[model samples]
Target: MVEEAPYRRIAAEIRERIARGDLAPGDRIPSTREITRDWGVAMATATKVINALREAGLVETRSGAGSVVIDRSSPQVEVVIQPDVPAHAGGFHVAASPRLRRAGEPELNRDRVVSSAVAIADAEGLSMLTMRRVAADLGVATMSLYRHVPSKEELILAMIDAVFGENPLPEEPPADWRARLETAARQMWQSFAAHPWAAEPLSLTRPQLLPNVLPYSEWSLGTLRELGFGVDEMMHIHLSLFGHVRASALNLDAELRAREDTGVTNDEWADQHGDELEAVLSAAAERFSALRYVAERGFDYDIAAVFESGLRLLLDGVAVALARREVSGDEQVDLSVV
Candidate 1:
């Protein structure tokens, strides 16, 4: 009698959950870490379990969302599992347990390893990510992961590429350059919002040259080129837009960490400090007239609203600067006037 592999056993249990409808369609499936924690398996084993479920059409990976139970009612193709036969007859019989995988299973691949890593970084911040941690989630031995990903840095780069690949570029961008730029900026902002940790790795000065990230630059530069902007100007515009989004997203990780450590949200923290803030503002009202006025009027401090407003203002200023340069035929327009 051949005992089932650890991964197969874990896969069988998840399959049973899906079959029982305990994991409804579109519901997030357990991640590698969650599986490891629950089943007391290594990361490699957890990865294999997810792979098995994927091969069996029980779950699918969602960018920044982790693995989700698929709608089994609409399976692309029906898979029929053969019954187990006796070992003496050169075939194994189906065991009484429902959770066993068939005789042969697919080997682990780089794609699965990267996707699992991305899921972990997305759920927790990048700080929580580690090679051993990722392996533990997958239920595989720590050493087994080295075969797929050489290092944590390489894994992070792969994760970035995977995230950028999630949203496909439009076949036809909006006709107007301003509209197109706005659309691109908003999309970038939304991506940062979804994966807060992503903003930290992306740098304006030291930009990464990943496959998915390059297209965004090409798209933005191409749009500006159509508007008669020089290459230098186009590149500046692209960097500015990306930098703005990244800057706004910088606080997301810190805020999330603060909440986790203190069990207090941003609003709660602000509320707790409100009395101290009021006393300080009142004491310095004469010197800080503007700050005091704004404080008295009250502010909602919504990050999304602020991001959109700043983006719109930035684009509007850029449009004005472009117009000035066009009318004056000046190669250098004083952008500060806008």
Candidate 2:
């Protein structure tokens, strides 16, 4: 006789849509903002609606992307709703997907857990990643994930290691030191580009000792060591190059989040504010002549392009230093060489 809670009512409606095939698997459901706008509900109520659906195994939240219907058709995974329950009852009966099954059945293991976590992190920023989310994606119970991965922190470390492993260092790296360094730097950058969320957790002060990453460090340091630089210089050079790449890679996630929130691309945003930008620059024409000049000419801001330029500049500086070290034993090399 009691009226249903707002969230349960909203969740039931969405569940009905999924049942009627109006929302299929992998289709994004309404965002919190969208739900609030459509239903005239508070943000908290909208959030509860999403959580309820997620708990019921009907949707999975992707970080910047809204919640999407999870595929339930796989014979390997199954979800059961209790029969004869009223739509507003707000209860779901679920059977946990087995971690181990018959020979032909898919088995949950360390690799599956790590890989699923990585995929989630890649799509949604690490902020959206949770054990429950990963289990939902894999069609297993949240607790089942803990059996393979001890904790969220450990799961993150494993994810990083797995990504690094994707681009293994060549068994026989390039013979030239410059080529070798370039190759190493590009490999690291590629990994960062593919997985934008990876840059932050890989701390410089407390570096994760990933198996695949160590080979890169060894190769970079060894490249400098061959140039007759001492261990100190070699380490410094390696860290410097790494810092450069990491600093640039961090932008990928920030920009992605910005775009998602604003629903506009960088160029589109620039276009929208073009007049305002020009007016600001024009007002301080004399004081900000250089800025005004670039603005007038139209600057194209590309992250990948900026990263490449900085990388070349840093490597060039290293090259110049090496040349100087060779020439004067103490004489400075001309900066023009770069």
Candidate 3:
């Protein structure tokens, strides 16, 4: 017998668990990170495993929940058409048809492929995006895509650059450094909000060297440099702003996934789980009085509002630090020690 691929073996193990009732419907399966940790496999391998499960209809991608077993017991309404039968007999049943490119369709090109991939990522989370899926969306064979985009990593980079290209910075900078930074921060946040999946690959530690993303860094650093901040301070402030926006936007993918999986919003999820949450909190009330009190009072958590409020506080702190630096006239201290 031919040996199975590594990803197929991993997928088989999970599938066996689902069959044995170890993984019930609505129960989350191992995430890509979790799979990597447990199986000593690369992220790409884990992704392939999940994709296999998804194709088998055994698991589905839920925004916040990663992958979960599909509820097979749930009633499904599908149109069944008998070929060459009268439509009136089956109440206007539509025949199933293969998805294929029509005659005179627009020629497939690299730009068309990239745009289609972006549209897929925008609608579904990046986890759901694959070369096969993109090809299906574009009505082309999977291998045909390879001619345009060499690999998934390159495609993702192109997608990132495309989205960043959407929001161009103004020719004239804001009068003040703070205003310029704030504008830059908000613009970045909005871009993340628009393409929630785009935020995933961005890392503060090992940043992607994309041309479009570099301009934002240049703009922020330039703004701070004009304010007399040293190189280290400029880098820190720029990263701080980017990190805040990115961290906040990171939840967008999970939230969207969760919403799709459970058919509930963040608020709805909280409300649905409120009783269980209260019970757990009540048991620990003696040890966590503050948390218990806050839980009882009910907090209206809006991420955007919190981001706005926190941005103001962070900028205020920066302003205070800048003022002190100006007054003291001291040379920049080495913050690298921390």
TM-score of every prediction relative to native: 0.68, 0.79, 0.69
Model 3, stretches more than 4 Å misplaced? Answer: 1-105, 331-338
**Global lDDT of each candidate:** 0.71, 0.77, 0.73
Candidate 2 lDDT over 144-209, as tens digits, reads: 998999999989988888898988888998877778988999999999888888888998888888
How many pairs of residues collide in each model?
21, 0, 5
Give the TM-score ranking, best first.
2, 3, 1
Select the stronger candidate by lDDT from 2 and 3. Answer: 2
Best by TM-score: 2
| Alpha-carbon RMSD of each model | 8.6, 4.9, 11.2
Whose TM-score is higher: candidate 1's or candidate 2's?
2
Per-residue lDDT of 1-338 in model 3, one digit per residue for the tens? Answer: 98767787888889889989999998988876567767888868877776556545566544445567777555541222224432221111123212323235568898888887787677557886889767645545689999989999989988888888889778798777778889888888888888889998887999888888888888899877766678898888888888888888887678876666556899988899999989988888888888889888998878788778878887887787677676687545232211
Model 1 misplaced regions, further than 4 Å: 1-106, 330-338
Pairs in steric clash, model 3: 62-257, 63-257, 63-258, 64-257, 64-258
Top-lDDT candidate index: 2
Question: Residue 335 of model 2: what lDDT?
Answer: 30
lDDT of 1 by residue, 1-338 (tens): 99878887777777777778899998988777677777888866776676566545466555566778766555343433323422111011233212222234345678878876887787656865777656544545568888988988888988888887877577799877777888888777777777778889887888889998787788889877766678788888888887888888877666765665455888888889989988998888898889878777878877788888889988987797688776888665443322
